[model samples]
Target: MHRLEQQFIDNQWVRSRGARYLPVMNPYREEVLAEVTAGAPQDVDDAVKTAQRALPAWRSLGGAKRATYLEGFAAALTRRREALVRLSSTNNGKVLAEAAIDLDDAIACYRYYADQARRLDERQGAAVSVEMANVEARCYHDPVGVVGLITPWNFPLVTSAWKLAPALAAGCTAVLKPSEVTPLPEQALAEIALEIGLPSGVLNLLNGDGEGIGAPLSRHAGIDKISFTGSNRVGEAVMAAAAERTVGVSLELGGKSPILVMEDADPEQAADWVMAGIYFNAGQICSATSRLLVHEAVADSLYSALEKRIDALVLGNPLAEQTDMGPLANARQRETVNGYLATAEQEGLRVVRDARHRQLPSRGYFVAPTLYRDVPLTSRLWKEEIFGPVLCGHSVANEQEAIALANDSDFGLAATVISGDGDRARRIGRELRAGSIWFNSEQLVLPETGWGGFKRSGIGRELGPWGLSSYLEVKHVIGPSHG
Candidate 1:
């Protein structure tokens, strides 16, 4: 039991005013890992005030100078990479390899955005109509003052790092509230930020439920922009809160992403990737390929191959080196996945693999992976974001039908098209409404590519230059005639 009790506000660890607090549970061991205070609406006021106070100077800092601090932060993270990996594995219930990769990704996000901030600046002007040379035309990428960030629990460290690194890179002071389920890492970052000379109040960390800290943060008048990653329902709530203040909002929401397997695709390779697409992180990823639609001609072979590979995967303690899969994050998540499995059976979908109830040590939460076939396009398991180790395979008559099925969902977060033919791959990838389309691959997030969703999936995006730009507001400046 690690005792950590502090709210990093204005660059110092402070105690919470609200009497409410919660236990931070380690999903791998189902033990009380830490005691965290639940920040209240009033605490949000302090955080926003702190960010507001730090904004002017922080935003005015030059790129090279900002890079110096970021470099220190990055180096600091590198030195503690091993501890981060262990904490991530213990808390997130992810395989150590996966947690290790998440930490590396955080480092990569920082290095990439640090460089971007140096190269890009908006305080200057640019060329316009040459005939009107006397006049000056320029665009500005100014910070949005205080940025409010609320990240999900699945990839708590990496995802929060996504918003924090870029928001800082853009010179925006931030008030970040990590999900209660996984707030330790973010709180830890708060400590590191203070030591790295992140500047008082430039970054604030709080722990609380959505109704407490998140709602207040979004609706806070001092917040100039909001960035959130969560379910569509919660995303809607945060957007509504931001709307109340008329602040800019960015979201990375729910996804029912599909993976299409073409007839010519390699069954050996495609099967493994498809299984990974839905099973990695125990299918909690927003971009997890929950739906698998294959060409009719190859559906049988592909399904069989996937079943064989998935069955051999090891699922147990996340700490073990041989563990390829781990338990759901908590008992509630386990119940949710189990409930979805029950519903899939009642909905007349054929459960190709009936998941067995596995017992874990009195310490942890665990669930066996599952695969369902013969599911109607409208089935709950097919259309909903299960956020667990469940995959539903459906047969498509042709490429066109596959594309239609992929687009049928209200979500448009991501899709994967597996095909040997470049033309067909391009066509399907293009037609998919998802923000991201993976072709002949899976489970890899690219730094340069833009990522977001359409419809109810999300607003704006995160990752790459796109993610960085979300923190900055565009402004046009006009100068008096020169010559």
Candidate 2:
């Protein structure tokens, strides 16, 4: 039984004032891995104040100095790569390969931001050419200051890295609230900071649920920005709370992204990509392609191939090297997925695969990958974001029908077009109302590209230069030229 019951505040591991403790469970084993302090509003205040105090000095260090710290953080992560992979797999119930990939992505993200930070002031800045004579105007990019980073449990370290690395790169101090389910990795990052002798109060971490810490952090006046990645409902609450102080907020919310398979696409290839998209990370990804719009000519063949590929998936311990899929992150998530399964059954959708046909470990929260076809357009199975390893497929007669069906949803986070014809794929990709679109392939997010959505999916991007901009405040400095 691991007991890690403390919050990292002002560069110190301090015991919480609150008495409650939240258990961090190994989702695959359904056992308590560790217990973390359930921080209260006072703890949130402490973290925010610490971050606020540290901001001025951190920003004054400028981009070059900040880059060195970020590079140090990246090196620290590299040294702890193996431990981080094991922790992520055990705590989050992701396959070992996925966990390793998550760490690698985080390391790359930090390094990318380190490079960006080194060149932030040099490569990018605004020096306007004014129309009026003897008038010289320039703009400066300044840190947003004391940002409150709230990341979800799905991809704990990677998501937090997206916010933290960029915030640090932009020369901002932050108070991070990792999900109560998986706060270990974020805490581990703080531990590395401590080991590297990072300045006090530059990066603080508070661990708690939404009610205990999230609300207070969002509404805190000392927090100049709130960068959040979670459910849309909570994101709305964060936005509303931040409105109280007019604080800057960047949210990467929920998604019900879809993929379109053209008639020209190979059924086998389409099946493989679609399976990977929906089942990777157990379909917990916000940009997951959960909805598939297939051309009628190839729908039957593609669906059959997908069923065969999905059946070949191995589900077991995340630590096991051969396990292709692991359990849901927690029992609650299993229940939620089961609820959706029941709804799909009631709606009379064609269930291609589910847990009823498979044997799973009785001890943990496990849900078999499911594929539903001929789903009603109005059913929740088609509209709601299940956020589990479930796919809802629809058949479209032509390209026009496919595009229309794909764009019918309230979400526009991501869409993919699979076609043999590159020209046709490019044309269709342009018509999809999503932030990210792929042609003939689907994989993980690239750090250099922007990642966000339209409509209810999300408000702002979270990676690349766009992500760095989210943590910065731009100001126009106008003065008379004494030439």
Candidate 3:
């Protein structure tokens, strides 16, 4: 078994001060995959202080130079792509194909932010027009300073990249606390940072549970900013911590996103998109479109197609090439999801499909892809973020009803609109109250697009220019027109 007992601090892999060690498991085999260090509150202090110390030099290094370092990170990721992909799959219980997609997205994020970093140089101190003739103004984007980056277990390296790339590109040093449940894949990031000669303490990686590292890091006074991607419960805690210090905070939280399929759409094609929406990454995606709102005229055909597709999914070892779906990240996740399933049974929800209909692996934390039709509007399964391959759906009378159902959610992270007519799909998509909307397509997220939603879904956006901006503070400078 792999033993990762050291935390990356000040560019060195040092044994953690905390005596606790958490076992990292391979969900598919129900075996211990690795033992990672659980960092102590002291470790958080050391990491945050180190990052605070390194901030000045790193920030003053200039955006063009930061872009070069970001490019180096991209290059290092490229060289270690295959190994990282396998590690991510093994640690996170996602299929190899999905793990590869995560790595690719990570690599692309670094490269994309590298370009943005270069542009920052040109944008710095750019002239701003003013109505008053005598006064000239310029705007400057400055680094927000030392930041604490906490990522969830589901996406592993992908979420790390989403936060880290932009934070670094914006010239901020960071202390990253990846989830203790699946920390193996994230270890590569620290290795790459050191290999690429990132300034000592510019990037500190601590492996631990929320209590051990995340809590301390979020509350650390040295941290000038906090960016977190996880559940709403933790996001609120982080926000409260940031409030104490009045520091900048960016949170990407939970979702019970919707997928609206119009009657005009082809059932077969819509089924594929629906499967990809809720089944990809075993529906661990925060932006998973788990609440399906189908047009009443086509509900029967769409449900039939979805049942067939769900049954066809290969549930086994994530490392296998043919495995379309893998076990949940860990036993706790499985238990949490199973609790929801049990509740659904108690509520007497119309279970269209579930694990009862499939023969799962002999040993694994697997949850068969589930579908519930005609679910009550008030059911927990219909409103809560299950974070599993559980799709709760019902029929809507028409496009208006579909749009109304889609918008009726506490979480507005994302939505999918499917229709034969592109114009109709786009028009309907425009009405959904989600941050990311897809029209006649699978759930495609790129580094160029912004992420994070309205209301309780999240506090700030990530990816694209918005991500880089999160780690930056803007300043306005005014002077005489001819100065």
Candidate 4:
């Protein structure tokens, strides 16, 4: 058994003060893979104080110098790529291919942020245009000081990289809390930091559930900001905690995103995109396009095609080469998804594919990829985020109706549009209310583009330049013109 009873703090692996230990399960095998320490509020205080102490020196190093550390992180990750891929697959119950993709995304994020950090040197003391002739003003982007980063169980290192890379690139020190359920993959980050000789207390990794680490970290007086990626309920709690000190906060929360398939779209192609949007990563993505709004003319054909694809999916051990999908991340997630399926049955929604119609693995937390058609807009299945390989959809009369239906949800995280006419798809995509919209394409996310949503989907953005900005505080210096 892999037992990790220590926390990474001040560049040292020290035993946690808390006595509680949580089991890390291999979801595919339905067995305990490791036991990790659950940190206490005292641990949070220690992490924050260490980060605070390190911030001044780390920030004073300047952004260009900081870029070298991020580059080192990327190189270290590249060296351990295969090992991390297998570890994430075992811990997260994602297919080996998807785990590899997650690692690649994490490595790319560090490299991208390294470039951004170098650019920060050029942008330092940038001149600001002012109305007064006698005034010369320049703006500086200072590090936001010590921050608390909380990442969910779903994407492991990927989400942590999204928050941590940019924070470090912006010259900020941080304390990170990975989900207790899937903490195995994230330990690699701390190891990488140590291997690269990242300055002591530059990044602290704490393993615990929401109460033990996340809550206290968010409320710590020493933390200048909190960046969290998780549920809406917890995001609100983090915001409330930040409000106590008027501390900065960046939240990436839930999504019940929609995909619109236009009348002219090919059924097979549309089905493929739809599956990719919702079923990738076992549909645990925060930007998962779980709702489908297909044109009435193609609804039947698209549904038929999607059903066939779902049936053809290979659900088995994530480490296996032939597996297309794996179990839910944990037993709790499986229960949550099963609860939604039960709700669908009570609502009398038409089930195109589900456990009743398909076979699942005999053991493990496996949920059959489910698809429901003719689902009412009022149904909970249509309105809520099931967060599994569950898809709910209905037919719309035209493009306007499709756009309306897609934008009707409380979420605006992501959406997809497919059409034979490229311009038409683009037009429809623009009308949808989401942070990211794709037209006749797969959901390809790059580190250069911003990721966040309008409405309740999230507050502020992550990734790209916006991500770097989240960890910076702007200051303007004004003086008499030299001329």
Candidate 5:
């Protein structure tokens, strides 16, 4: 019903003066919610032009002034908290609780960057006490001109904030192209930009297809860097495109994370956290712990507990407060999940949890949370990225075996280890080859730590002061020559 057929360029809403528009649908309701203008090359050109024009002024501003601007962006975001949360739930099919957290996450990113930029410092080389007369060395970090950010629909607004806040805090301009599936948040964010008094062209959003929007933006000569968050397949494409232009790219991609339940871990608690990790957002998250590595001693009890939890999952409308899990984004996701389930059966894995498609009003897509036991490493459910409410159980003989199993995967974005003792947890956490390791908990990503992946999981980190470095370039200066 809503027409978002205008792209945000040069700090103003511009209708598709250059090209046609397309519909962005609500996966939960299986209906078109808004139309996005398929922003063309001209749009990217305009955004880059404005960004280049504003760069000198923005960079010249003091750190305190930049921090103030970031705070302004945060304040504006707070005013539309409720509306953004609702839109997130409607478009992405995440529950209200999750949607609210998305808005909170965005605010946190902005606030954190503001604080980081305020206290930012540069150091001059220490004066040598030796025979040196007068030699000076200095190192300073500076922003990398224009940044191009491409976000996924799964966590559109929140992820956008992660890239946008840091890049802007580091004094970089941005050209953001949010996913066409859930482009409303970017539109809403553009309106917030005006409220925040952000300098024109400092932050711009373009809506269009990959070739129409992403390729042009990434391949643009004026753009200094690129940041992308999405699936591995598309990530490869983005890398290739950026490589052609010889531009830097920060990629946050797919994950087949594992959860290792130590022998001493309480099965009841481990089972609860395991279910929450993968099935919380209908298991559409990249960091979903799809593989459960259980010590042989606790395997039986843990599997029993996990079976009970999945069996109790309520399959209903996401808007309903009582619904424990919603559908997998859309029909393609549903069919993909169902196909994995069918393949699980074909692979001879014992599926203990009921994964039948729960029929409701037949208006939206819905699928039950499923669990497969004794699934081999080669099984369909074990290897492929289901991106839905599907978890596979793998029983291991001991801690060593459990660690081996966890590290065997091609993807290693994140892993959760549930144990009673702190020493054991810390030891195992260190051994886990993951960007993030949660001990005695799951899926709690804080603002202070860095998050990314190893292997095919991702390229660079996000969150914290170090995250800002991703959008910055370091320069070394040697001066004060004695004549």
Candidate 6:
């Protein structure tokens, strides 16, 4: 068992102000694998003060120096990738393969931002001609002081890397409050940051739930910006809390993303994409394609392929090399998903797949993958975000119908289009109201591309240069020029 009994503050692993502790459980085993200090509002205040104290020095260190630190940090991640993967699997309950991807993505993100940081000086100031003869204008991107970053339980370290990397690269000091349910991975990350010699107060980690740290962090006057990733419910609270200070906030909220399978698409490939989109990580992912909008002509063939694919999946211990999927991260998540399933049944949706249909272990927070077809537009299964290994399928009469159903969600985080014709797929992708769209493929978030959503999915982007901009405040300098 692991015990992360201290929070990282002011470059030290210090005991929390509160004596309470939270147990970190392995959802696959349904047992406590570790314990972390449960930080309180005072802890948030201290971390914020420390980060605020360190911001000026860290930002003055110049982008190039920050780039060097990041590159070194990426190297450190490579050296410890396997350990991180195992910790992630144990703490977050994702399969080994998925956990590995989290570590790999974190490494790639840090490297990508390291390069961006190096070019920060070049990208900063842009000279512009002024209407007044004696005046000259230029714009610069400055660091957004102390930032409070709240990451979710799913993809703990990778999500932290998405926010923390850019925040640091943009020359901002940070106080990261990772999900209390999955604090182990973030603890390891904080250790790595200290090992790499990140300056004192540059990066502080506070382990706690929303009341303990998230709410307080968002409202802290010392925090100049707030970056959060989680359910839309909490994201709303974060926004409201930050409003007290009117601090800059970036939110990557919930999504009910859809996968549109065209009649001309290969049935086998389409089914594979659909399964991966929802069943991977047991459907806890924010951008999980929970809704499957397919052409009526090909729905049967695709469902047949999906049934075969689902039966072959290996659902077991996350540590096993052969395990294709793991349990939900916690019991609360499992109950929430089961509640949605019950609602789906009550709403008269046809169940295409169910847990009883497959052979599986009876322990842990395991909800076998499920699919519901002929789901009406008004059904909760179709309208609400179940956030489980459950897919709500709808048959569309034509391409236009499919597009309409796909864009029906309040969320516009992500959408996938599968079509044999490249131009046709591109045309459909263009029309989808989502931040990220996949054409003739499945969901894949690259480090260089922006990832966020439209409408209620989120307020701002989280990856690429767009992510860096979240931690920066632009300034226009106007003065007399002798040129």
Residue lDDT tens for model 6, 292-373: 9998889999999998888888898998999998999999999999898788767877878887567777677888999888
Q: What is the lDDT of candidate 6?
A: 0.89
Deviating ranges (above 4 Å) for candidate 1? 130-133, 357-363
Tell me the tens digit of each residue's lDDT in model 1 across 351-410: 776675444345567767788886887788888889998889988888888888889998
Candidate 3 residue runs with Cα over 4 Å from true position: none
What digit string (tens of lDDT, one per residue) describes model 3 on residues 224-281? 9999999999999999999999998898999989999999999999999999999999
**What lDDT is reached at residue 192 by model 4?**
88
For 1-483, candidate 5 gives per-residue lDDT tens digits of 777667787789877544677777777778888777777888888888888998998886756678888888788878988888888888888887878788898888889988887765432233333444576655677888898999988888789988998888888988989998778776777887888788888888888878688878878889989999988988998898888888889999888999988889999998889988989888988899999888888888998898778767776677778877766676777888878877876777887775774444466677777787778988867877788888898888888888888888888899999888878988998998999998888688777789799999989999976688898888866656562
- Candidate 5 lDDT: 0.82
Clash pairs, model 4 backbone: none
Question: Which residue pairs of candidate 5 clash?
Answer: none
**What's the TM-score of every candidate structure?**
0.96, 0.98, 0.98, 0.99, 0.95, 0.98
Local distance difference test values of all predictions, in order: 0.83, 0.88, 0.91, 0.91, 0.82, 0.89
Query: Which portions of model 2 miss their true places by more than 4 Å?
Result: 123-126
TM-score of 3: 0.98
Worst 10-residue lDDT window, candidate 1 = 121-130
Better of 3 and 5 by TM-score: 3
Worst 10 residues of 4 by lDDT: 354-363
Please list the residue runs of candidate 6 whose C-alpha ends up more than 4 Å from where it truly belongs after superposition.
Answer: none
lDDT of 2: 0.88
